[model samples]
Target: MMNDEQKTDKKQRLIRKGKKVQEPVNTQLVVNIFEGFTKDERDLTQAHMGAEYFRVMAWIKEEDEQETIGVRSFRGFHQFNERLVFPLDCSSYKYIYIELIKVHSRRDPATSKGTVVMGRAKIRLPPWTSRGKFTSKFNLVGLNSDRCVEIKGYLNLSMQLHRYLER
Candidate 1:
Protein backbone atom coordinates (compact mmCIF):
# COMPACT_ATOMS: atom_id res chain seq x y z
CA MET A 1 0.00 0.00 0.00
CA MET A 2 1.30 3.46 -0.95
CA ASN A 3 1.02 6.43 1.41
CA ASP A 4 -0.20 9.85 0.19
CA GLU A 5 3.36 11.25 0.14
CA GLN A 6 4.65 8.25 -1.81
CA LYS A 7 1.76 8.50 -4.22
CA THR A 8 2.40 12.14 -4.84
CA ASP A 9 6.13 11.53 -5.39
CA LYS A 10 5.44 8.68 -7.79
CA LYS A 11 2.95 10.83 -9.70
CA GLN A 12 5.47 13.60 -9.99
CA ARG A 13 8.15 11.25 -11.24
CA LEU A 14 5.76 9.83 -13.81
CA ILE A 15 4.90 13.33 -15.00
CA ARG A 16 8.56 14.21 -15.30
CA LYS A 17 9.24 11.00 -17.21
CA GLY A 18 6.47 11.83 -19.67
CA LYS A 19 7.93 15.24 -20.42
CA LYS A 20 11.24 16.06 -22.11
CA VAL A 21 13.20 18.05 -19.61
CA GLN A 22 16.09 19.94 -21.15
CA GLU A 23 19.37 20.05 -19.38
CA PRO A 24 20.55 23.27 -17.84
CA VAL A 25 23.15 25.18 -19.87
CA ASN A 26 26.42 24.22 -18.28
CA THR A 27 28.81 25.66 -20.86
CA GLN A 28 29.34 28.75 -22.97
CA LEU A 29 31.05 29.58 -26.26
CA VAL A 30 32.67 32.98 -26.39
CA VAL A 31 33.71 34.56 -29.66
CA ASN A 32 35.56 37.78 -30.32
CA ILE A 33 35.18 39.08 -33.86
CA PHE A 34 38.15 41.23 -34.71
CA GLU A 35 38.53 42.38 -38.27
CA GLY A 36 38.01 41.67 -41.93
CA PHE A 37 40.58 41.91 -44.73
CA THR A 38 40.12 42.82 -48.34
CA LYS A 39 42.23 41.47 -51.15
CA ASP A 40 42.31 44.52 -53.35
CA GLU A 41 43.01 48.03 -52.14
CA ARG A 42 44.39 49.96 -55.08
CA ASP A 43 40.96 51.00 -56.26
CA LEU A 44 39.96 52.09 -52.79
CA THR A 45 42.95 54.48 -52.63
CA GLN A 46 42.45 55.67 -56.16
CA ALA A 47 39.19 55.38 -58.04
CA HIS A 48 36.88 54.11 -55.32
CA MET A 49 38.23 56.07 -52.38
CA GLY A 50 35.66 56.29 -49.62
CA ALA A 51 33.06 54.91 -51.97
CA GLU A 52 32.79 51.43 -50.46
CA TYR A 53 31.11 50.41 -47.25
CA PHE A 54 31.08 46.97 -45.69
CA ARG A 55 29.51 45.10 -42.80
CA VAL A 56 30.37 41.84 -41.16
CA MET A 57 27.57 39.67 -39.83
CA ALA A 58 27.79 36.57 -37.72
CA TRP A 59 25.46 33.88 -36.39
CA ILE A 60 25.44 30.31 -35.08
CA LYS A 61 22.27 28.93 -36.55
CA GLU A 62 20.17 28.02 -39.50
CA GLU A 63 17.60 30.20 -37.75
CA ASP A 64 16.94 33.91 -37.90
CA GLU A 65 18.99 34.97 -34.87
CA GLN A 66 22.04 36.98 -35.95
CA GLU A 67 24.32 39.86 -34.99
CA THR A 68 25.80 42.39 -37.37
CA ILE A 69 28.36 45.14 -37.00
CA GLY A 70 27.65 48.66 -38.04
CA VAL A 71 28.48 49.79 -41.55
CA ARG A 72 32.07 50.92 -41.92
CA SER A 73 33.38 53.14 -44.66
CA PHE A 74 36.94 52.12 -45.09
CA ARG A 75 39.46 51.70 -47.82
CA GLY A 76 41.24 48.51 -46.90
CA PHE A 77 40.10 46.58 -43.88
CA HIS A 78 37.11 46.45 -41.55
CA GLN A 79 37.72 46.33 -37.81
CA PHE A 80 35.21 45.18 -35.24
CA ASN A 81 36.16 44.18 -31.72
CA GLU A 82 32.78 42.65 -30.97
CA ARG A 83 32.21 39.84 -28.54
CA LEU A 84 29.31 37.40 -28.60
CA VAL A 85 28.47 34.76 -26.06
CA PHE A 86 26.30 31.73 -26.70
CA PRO A 87 24.93 29.46 -24.00
CA LEU A 88 25.56 25.87 -24.94
CA ASP A 89 23.39 22.85 -24.37
CA CYS A 90 24.78 19.44 -23.66
CA SER A 91 22.98 17.96 -26.63
CA SER A 92 25.21 19.34 -29.40
CA TYR A 93 27.54 22.07 -30.56
CA LYS A 94 27.01 24.50 -33.40
CA TYR A 95 29.34 26.25 -35.82
CA ILE A 96 29.87 29.99 -36.00
CA TYR A 97 29.23 31.43 -39.44
CA ILE A 98 30.42 34.75 -40.83
CA GLU A 99 29.44 36.78 -43.83
CA LEU A 100 30.94 39.97 -45.25
CA ILE A 101 28.44 42.07 -47.09
CA LYS A 102 28.86 45.17 -49.22
CA VAL A 103 26.24 47.63 -48.12
CA HIS A 104 24.90 50.36 -50.38
CA SER A 105 25.52 53.87 -49.19
CA ARG A 106 23.15 55.87 -51.34
CA ARG A 107 25.42 55.37 -54.30
CA ASP A 108 24.75 52.06 -55.94
CA PRO A 109 21.31 51.34 -57.43
CA ALA A 110 21.90 47.89 -58.79
CA THR A 111 20.15 45.47 -56.40
CA SER A 112 16.83 46.19 -54.81
CA LYS A 113 17.98 45.51 -51.28
CA GLY A 114 21.55 46.56 -52.17
CA THR A 115 23.41 44.08 -50.05
CA VAL A 116 25.82 41.61 -51.64
CA VAL A 117 27.63 38.71 -50.04
CA MET A 118 31.29 39.34 -50.72
CA GLY A 119 32.86 36.72 -48.53
CA ARG A 120 31.87 33.91 -46.21
CA ALA A 121 33.49 31.74 -43.56
CA LYS A 122 32.54 28.92 -41.21
CA ILE A 123 34.29 28.36 -37.90
CA ARG A 124 33.90 25.08 -36.06
CA LEU A 125 33.22 24.91 -32.37
CA PRO A 126 35.98 24.14 -29.91
CA PRO A 127 36.16 20.58 -28.66
CA TRP A 128 33.67 19.98 -25.90
CA THR A 129 36.06 17.58 -24.21
CA SER A 130 38.71 20.28 -23.74
CA ARG A 131 38.80 23.74 -22.21
CA GLY A 132 40.96 26.04 -24.27
CA LYS A 133 41.07 29.12 -26.45
CA PHE A 134 42.07 29.53 -30.11
CA THR A 135 42.89 32.69 -31.99
CA SER A 136 43.54 32.59 -35.72
CA LYS A 137 42.62 34.06 -39.04
CA PHE A 138 40.20 32.18 -41.28
CA ASN A 139 40.00 32.61 -44.98
CA LEU A 140 36.88 34.06 -46.53
CA VAL A 141 36.05 32.81 -49.99
CA GLY A 142 33.79 33.97 -52.77
CA LEU A 143 32.90 33.01 -56.31
CA ASN A 144 34.90 34.50 -59.15
CA SER A 145 34.06 35.26 -62.76
CA ASP A 146 33.71 31.61 -63.76
CA ARG A 147 31.78 30.81 -60.59
CA CYS A 148 34.76 29.08 -59.04
CA VAL A 149 35.31 29.92 -55.43
CA GLU A 150 38.48 31.83 -54.47
CA ILE A 151 39.85 33.34 -51.34
CA LYS A 152 38.60 36.86 -51.03
CA GLY A 153 40.20 37.85 -47.76
CA TYR A 154 40.52 36.77 -44.17
CA LEU A 155 38.63 37.13 -40.89
CA ASN A 156 40.56 37.27 -37.65
CA LEU A 157 38.84 36.12 -34.47
CA SER A 158 39.25 34.22 -31.25
CA MET A 159 37.08 31.60 -29.61
CA GLN A 160 37.06 29.98 -26.20
CA LEU A 161 35.07 27.20 -24.60
CA HIS A 162 34.19 27.73 -20.96
CA ARG A 163 32.47 25.16 -18.77
CA TYR A 164 30.99 25.95 -15.40
CA LEU A 165 32.57 24.11 -12.51
CA GLU A 166 29.50 22.62 -10.97
CA ARG A 167 29.60 21.89 -7.27
Candidate 2:
Protein backbone atom coordinates (compact mmCIF):
# COMPACT_ATOMS: atom_id res chain seq x y z
CA MET A 1 0.00 0.00 0.00
CA MET A 2 1.26 3.44 -0.91
CA ASN A 3 1.19 6.27 1.57
CA ASP A 4 -0.61 9.55 0.95
CA GLU A 5 2.60 11.21 -0.15
CA GLN A 6 3.40 8.60 -2.78
CA LYS A 7 -0.12 8.62 -4.16
CA THR A 8 -0.02 12.38 -4.47
CA ASP A 9 3.12 12.15 -6.60
CA LYS A 10 1.78 10.70 -9.80
CA LYS A 11 4.72 12.06 -11.73
CA GLN A 12 7.07 9.40 -10.41
CA ARG A 13 8.33 7.40 -13.38
CA LEU A 14 10.44 4.27 -13.62
CA ILE A 15 13.42 3.81 -15.91
CA ARG A 16 12.94 1.06 -18.46
CA LYS A 17 16.06 0.16 -20.49
CA GLY A 18 17.89 3.49 -20.18
CA LYS A 19 15.14 6.01 -20.83
CA LYS A 20 12.62 7.46 -18.41
CA VAL A 21 9.03 6.66 -19.24
CA GLN A 22 5.70 7.83 -17.78
CA GLU A 23 3.17 5.03 -17.87
CA PRO A 24 0.78 4.11 -15.12
CA VAL A 25 1.68 0.47 -15.47
CA ASN A 26 5.08 -1.16 -15.41
CA THR A 27 3.67 -4.60 -14.67
CA GLN A 28 0.55 -6.51 -15.60
CA LEU A 29 -1.69 -8.58 -13.34
CA VAL A 30 -3.89 -11.21 -14.90
CA VAL A 31 -6.90 -12.43 -12.92
CA ASN A 32 -9.06 -15.29 -14.05
CA ILE A 33 -12.31 -15.17 -12.06
CA PHE A 34 -14.03 -18.49 -12.55
CA GLU A 35 -16.70 -19.30 -9.97
CA GLY A 36 -18.00 -18.82 -6.44
CA PHE A 37 -18.95 -21.67 -4.16
CA THR A 38 -21.25 -21.49 -1.18
CA LYS A 39 -20.33 -22.64 2.26
CA ASP A 40 -23.92 -23.37 3.21
CA GLU A 41 -24.60 -25.92 5.85
CA ARG A 42 -28.12 -26.82 4.66
CA ASP A 43 -29.38 -27.78 1.24
CA LEU A 44 -30.61 -24.88 -0.91
CA THR A 45 -29.54 -22.51 1.86
CA GLN A 46 -27.36 -20.50 -0.51
CA ALA A 47 -28.58 -21.94 -3.77
CA HIS A 48 -32.16 -20.69 -3.75
CA MET A 49 -31.69 -17.47 -1.81
CA GLY A 50 -29.90 -15.51 -4.50
CA ALA A 51 -30.43 -12.29 -6.38
CA GLU A 52 -31.52 -11.74 -9.96
CA TYR A 53 -28.16 -10.54 -11.13
CA PHE A 54 -24.58 -10.85 -9.86
CA ARG A 55 -21.23 -9.25 -10.69
CA VAL A 56 -17.70 -8.93 -9.38
CA MET A 57 -15.38 -6.01 -8.68
CA ALA A 58 -11.64 -6.31 -8.15
CA TRP A 59 -8.76 -3.93 -7.63
CA ILE A 60 -5.06 -3.90 -6.93
CA LYS A 61 -3.89 -1.99 -3.86
CA GLU A 62 -1.07 0.36 -4.86
CA GLU A 63 -1.70 -0.01 -8.58
CA ASP A 64 -5.26 1.29 -8.16
CA GLU A 65 -6.58 -0.77 -11.08
CA GLN A 66 -10.27 -1.38 -10.49
CA GLU A 67 -12.68 -3.25 -12.76
CA THR A 68 -16.13 -4.83 -12.73
CA ILE A 69 -17.27 -7.95 -14.49
CA GLY A 70 -20.23 -7.95 -16.85
CA VAL A 71 -23.71 -8.52 -15.43
CA ARG A 72 -24.84 -12.12 -15.43
CA SER A 73 -27.66 -14.09 -13.88
CA PHE A 74 -26.71 -16.13 -10.84
CA ARG A 75 -26.83 -19.77 -11.80
CA GLY A 76 -25.25 -22.62 -9.89
CA PHE A 77 -21.85 -21.76 -8.39
CA HIS A 78 -22.26 -18.13 -9.41
CA GLN A 79 -20.73 -19.21 -12.66
CA PHE A 80 -18.69 -16.57 -14.47
CA ASN A 81 -15.47 -17.46 -16.16
CA GLU A 82 -14.12 -13.98 -16.77
CA ARG A 83 -10.51 -13.22 -17.61
CA LEU A 84 -9.54 -9.79 -16.25
CA VAL A 85 -6.21 -8.24 -17.16
CA PHE A 86 -5.05 -5.25 -15.14
CA PRO A 87 -2.00 -3.09 -15.81
CA LEU A 88 -0.09 -2.19 -12.68
CA ASP A 89 2.37 0.65 -12.26
CA CYS A 90 4.54 -1.27 -9.83
CA SER A 91 4.65 -4.49 -7.84
CA SER A 92 3.77 -2.74 -4.60
CA TYR A 93 0.38 -4.45 -4.65
CA LYS A 94 0.21 -7.58 -2.54
CA TYR A 95 -3.47 -8.43 -2.50
CA ILE A 96 -6.30 -8.45 -5.03
CA TYR A 97 -9.40 -7.17 -3.27
CA ILE A 98 -12.58 -8.87 -4.46
CA GLU A 99 -16.14 -7.62 -4.14
CA LEU A 100 -19.17 -9.62 -5.14
CA ILE A 101 -21.57 -6.97 -6.37
CA LYS A 102 -25.34 -7.27 -6.52
CA VAL A 103 -26.59 -5.27 -9.50
CA HIS A 104 -29.68 -3.17 -8.94
CA SER A 105 -32.94 -3.75 -10.76
CA ARG A 106 -35.49 -1.11 -11.65
CA ARG A 107 -38.10 -3.46 -13.05
CA ASP A 108 -38.40 -5.46 -9.85
CA PRO A 109 -40.95 -3.85 -7.56
CA ALA A 110 -39.03 -4.94 -4.50
CA THR A 111 -35.89 -3.15 -5.59
CA SER A 112 -35.00 0.07 -3.79
CA LYS A 113 -31.39 0.99 -4.43
CA GLY A 114 -28.33 0.82 -6.68
CA THR A 115 -25.75 -1.96 -6.94
CA VAL A 116 -24.84 -3.50 -3.59
CA VAL A 117 -21.53 -5.09 -2.73
CA MET A 118 -21.99 -8.38 -0.97
CA GLY A 119 -19.34 -10.91 0.16
CA ARG A 120 -15.73 -9.72 -0.05
CA ALA A 121 -12.37 -11.48 -0.14
CA LYS A 122 -8.66 -10.73 -0.43
CA ILE A 123 -6.39 -12.89 -2.61
CA ARG A 124 -2.81 -12.69 -1.45
CA LEU A 125 -0.21 -12.32 -4.20
CA PRO A 126 2.22 -15.17 -4.55
CA PRO A 127 5.63 -14.95 -2.89
CA TRP A 128 7.40 -15.25 -6.25
CA THR A 129 9.17 -12.05 -7.26
CA SER A 130 8.59 -12.56 -10.99
CA ARG A 131 6.07 -14.17 -13.31
CA GLY A 132 4.14 -16.98 -11.66
CA LYS A 133 0.63 -18.25 -10.97
CA PHE A 134 -1.35 -18.73 -7.77
CA THR A 135 -4.56 -20.65 -7.99
CA SER A 136 -6.98 -21.54 -5.17
CA LYS A 137 -10.14 -20.67 -3.34
CA PHE A 138 -10.31 -17.69 -1.04
CA ASN A 139 -12.95 -17.11 1.63
CA LEU A 140 -14.81 -13.87 1.96
CA VAL A 141 -14.04 -11.81 5.05
CA GLY A 142 -16.16 -9.55 7.18
CA LEU A 143 -14.72 -6.75 9.25
CA ASN A 144 -16.20 -5.80 12.58
CA SER A 145 -15.70 -2.85 14.87
CA ASP A 146 -12.43 -4.29 16.10
CA ARG A 147 -11.08 -4.53 12.54
CA CYS A 148 -11.00 -8.29 12.73
CA VAL A 149 -11.41 -10.61 9.76
CA GLU A 150 -14.07 -13.34 9.69
CA ILE A 151 -13.85 -15.88 6.90
CA LYS A 152 -17.03 -16.27 4.93
CA GLY A 153 -17.75 -18.19 1.69
CA TYR A 154 -15.37 -18.98 -1.16
CA LEU A 155 -14.25 -17.19 -4.36
CA ASN A 156 -12.40 -19.42 -6.79
CA LEU A 157 -9.90 -17.84 -9.13
CA SER A 158 -6.30 -17.58 -10.34
CA MET A 159 -3.83 -14.69 -10.37
CA GLN A 160 -0.68 -14.22 -12.42
CA LEU A 161 1.88 -11.44 -12.37
CA HIS A 162 4.21 -10.41 -15.22
CA ARG A 163 6.75 -7.65 -15.45
CA TYR A 164 6.80 -5.52 -18.57
CA LEU A 165 9.12 -6.82 -21.26
CA GLU A 166 11.13 -4.82 -23.73
CA ARG A 167 10.28 -5.06 -27.40
Q: Which regions in candidate 1 have their CA more than 4 angstroms from the true location?
A: 1-25, 40-51, 71-73, 105-108, 165-167
Clashing pairs in 2: none
lDDT against true structure, model 2: 0.65
- lDDT per residue for candidate 1 within 29-137, as digits (tens), equals 7888888786642344544535666777777765634565665746558887888777776637558788888777343457787776778988888887767789999
**TM-score, each model?**
0.72, 0.61
Q: Tell how far residue 18 is off in model 1, in angstroms.
A: 30
What clash count does candidate 2 reach?
A: 0
**How much lDDT does candidate 1 score?**
0.74
> How close to the true structure is residue 110 of candidate 2, measured as C-alpha lDDT?
61
**How many clashing pairs per prediction, in order?**
0, 0
Q: After superposition, how far is residue 5 of candidate 2 from its true place, in Å?
A: 30
Q: Residue 81 error for model 2, in Å? A: 1.0
| RMSD after CA superposition, every candidate | 5.9, 10.1
